[model samples]
Target chain A: MNTSVNIAGVCFKNPVTTASGTFGSGKEYSEFFDLGRLGAVTVKGVATTEWKGNNCPRIAETYGGMLNSVGLQNPGVDYFIKNDIPFLRKYDTKIIVNICGHTVSEYCEVTERLSDEDIDLFELNISCPNVSAGGITFGTDAKMAETVVSEVKKYAKKPLIVKLTPNVTDITEIARAVVSGGADAVSLINTLKGMKIDINTRKAFLANKFGGLSGPAVKPVALRMVYEVNKAVDVPIIGMGGISNTEDALEFIMAGATMISVGTANFANPYATVEIVDGIKEYMEKNNIKDLSEIRGIIE
Target chain B: MKKFIFAEVVEIKHMIEDIYDMYVYAPEIAKNAKPGQFAEIYTGLGEAILPRPISFCEIIKEKGLIRFCFRVVGKGTKHFSEMKKGDKLRLLGPLGNGFEIPDAPQKSIVIGGGIGIPPLLELCKHLKGEVHVFLGTREEPILVEDFEKTGAIVHVCTENGCTGYHGYAITLVDELNIPADMIYSCGPKIMLKIVSDWAKKKNIRAQVSMEERMACGIGVCCGCAIKIQKKGEDDWHSLKVCKDGPVFWNDEVIW
Candidate 1:
């Protein structure tokens, strides 16, 4: 398979990257699938400070989906430096670290410290709603989104890709904000804030009361956001949210995304990412396509 | 170890004394599955998504089948108990980490309480030394023949004296009078705690498996985690059972 793709100044072995949080630490996934085959690996959202994250019933199962309120439970920046970073050292794939901060200093602090390490890129994630304040999710407000991108860009020696949320009223405007704020690229459509009611207890299913929703149901909303953002920004886009298979990944690329990430579906099938990667190669081969860039926006 | 799609429904009937006899369709779990390993069996085929995790019991590799004996507790199991011959089940398996069997033990006394006996059955099949198993369930709980087939001397415990020992399994463990070099146990929380505390006092090696709320059956989400201090200080570390372990050295496991 012609499995090579590029983003900004960086290159990936393939276009298949595991979604943050789902590929916890990366070693376990290696048990089922080879980590080196992936284009890049996204670590779980790392917070400036250690967070306990939401309460249990942290995850609840829906008809064909599940909701998780993990509350961004992380081993603080210091711990990540000690524990997580050392483990990623074994993998040869591009390492894109996702960072979350409750305040401005926290974001800068984490990025500044990480600046010393060998990393491929930085994903300024201002989309976690389960946090206190600085997680104001700059992605929701256009101006705030730009400011986060610009601030993190200061210490981030690597290319910056701002991960956006779908809870906003106008997603394109938010995309434009990050682009204007000097973002080298964009990753679209984080999970949507959703809740499920249990008929048994006559209450919310997730103990955290609410969680980010991702799966087939949110695919349309995700696609719409990616389409609008692809048109609004000149930077390359990484699209996500319920992208379970090759057709789904192709849809995002057609809608103007250069690369794609797989979330929620990784749970059902641990090898979902590799399957999508293989599926894409087969799709390209069958279609007689030589370059993935040729179909980046070839929407019929 | 490898993913194979071959699934078959094996009809197993207890030819022993009196017990529930029925056939169940189960996936091959223990071929490459380590001890303390488990699998999820869905009641129906079409996209129910959530499959209940059943600890892998004794395995019969020659027949390409494994067994998991469980008590019918709620809606899911009730549906399973009613399932008879020719019923197909979609199973996702070798799911969680299995028990880490140490190099060797001079002598090990295995303690099983009620439903906990199944996982231990798989572990005992690989033992080299003298192995003594003490099974605790209200005697004649369900399938006595299945327990006996594992080739371990089985001791039964029932509350009303319906079968063997007339008390909790812990009482049976006390009556066993077996010398323990290494002890491994699984079952109810109270039973595990009692064994964990007792083993700690005796300075014996022991490990316990814990069942907590699990969602994805993988480490994607941190749903099932217990606060265990990292073998040192008073500080507690949260470890996910789906990934970190369903098994831990008894002392290292913070109840």
Candidate 2:
């Protein structure tokens, strides 16, 4: 009956939380479901300054999934501390702030700014595929990943969860690097870099030419990476990527993730997070499983 | 507490080639629905992950019906065309900030092109002032009859000269020398830019409903962002098309 998960010293009421960028500070989804029902609300990425994001055609539909190059458009960390934090505080859930930037200083600056704010955790987004500079660069390179994580760890007051990008030669190598640099936990895999071309227009469907593919299409790869990283690192893993239902979440938990974040699935079903929460409870009751730890990483 | 619900399709009529008019019995949406508001309809197409945002073409409150006229632009819309009467579609809406009609204008100009014309009809039906409707299309017009029923003075333009004016809707607006105290428009981005520019020149107050590739018809995704001048500020701000507005004041838009 105990679904609470502990990552580092932070205790989530339940193992269910929304993936960053997918849930916009919990204000938007708060209409569909109560924020109090969620274990944590992972907000959109915030940078040093407001970002304009990318050009038009930012989203496209593919088989069983979708692609987006939103470029982490946000209103900056100051705005989050002022507007979004107060709004989210009204809810009875933990708040995990996702921080994105073009440089290590930008990431550290956001962390330092939010250090005084009423937040629970920090999901350092070094894996955004849309932005050309600090995003994918810090994620894909083991050395840069280690340096950024270590530097941000210095300023981040809350537990740091380094979100890893899947576009790499060895996902586990980068996973090990972040944990070595003092990361409390790890979340993976941020969308896979992919492209879609409009047949009639004879051009890229997305304005950015390449976008991160999420949803059912990337589930297998995300699972493989989570499994690989779980074996490679000692830190707790938050498995995500195409988790649409309770079964998908259980698969991630059994594959060695302490918790799972629902990303693209929230688009398909607005009440997806709540549904997964209820479904997991039902699954545990039906299976006569008392603790989530019993099934955590049970899959060999 | 979920905004999404299943609405039973009461009727579906083929208005023109690849264009159809659909009415769904959704009392909840009808009760609070306004002009320029759109609904994200689940197209039942298994491959299509996101819902299609269709503007409310007509809101029949007494009967609890909402009409939408859509063109078969892609696979998602094509699936909407295939749905039969009595079918049910899951829709989330009355979403976004809709058009704000001023108290009593001297006259209102409602300009619309292609699929964008549908939402303007509901606007025309609500306005108390003198309404002037200008519709432009590629070849055939979709809702000419509906626009006429709104009692608005209608002007039609077809690019092939198959109907009224032989060019864009602005051509007729120019030749006829129509005067407007207020304006509302929705259409292709290029046409909106042109109309937005025209409104700026004449010092007329105008509102436009913008469109973009949207994932969550609600504001979360940040997928449908449009550049807008922050209120009382010269700097541009990224506004979500699904949340802050699909309808924005002309001056606010960074056209």
Clashing pairs for predicted structure model 2, backbone only? A1-A290
Model 1, A182-269: lDDT tens digits are: 8898897887888989888899877778887776668888998898888788998999987888999999888887888988776666
lDDT of 2 at B193: 88
lDDT of 1 by residue, B1-255 (tens): 224233455664432232223333343554556778877666442233445667777666666576766666545555666665666655667777777676775577778877777788778877657766777775455445555665656667777787777887767777666777888888887889999888887788787877765655766567776667766677766777776778877888767
Poorly placed runs, candidate 1 (over 4 Å) = A1-5, A48-55, A76-92, A132-138, A196-205, A298-300, B1-31, B40-46, B50-52, B61-64, B70-97, B100-117, B124-140, B148-183, B188-206, B215-220
Query: Every model's DockQ, to 2 decimals?
Result: 0.33, 0.75
Model 2 lDDT tens row, A7-55: 9898888899999989889887887778998889999999999998998
TM-score, each model? 0.80, 0.98
What are the per-model C-alpha RMSD values against the true structure?
4.8, 1.3
Interface quality of candidate 2 as DockQ: 0.75
Give all candidates' CA lDDT scores: 0.74, 0.90
Report how far residue B242 has shifted in candidate 2, in Å: 0.8
Interface RMSD of 1: 2.5
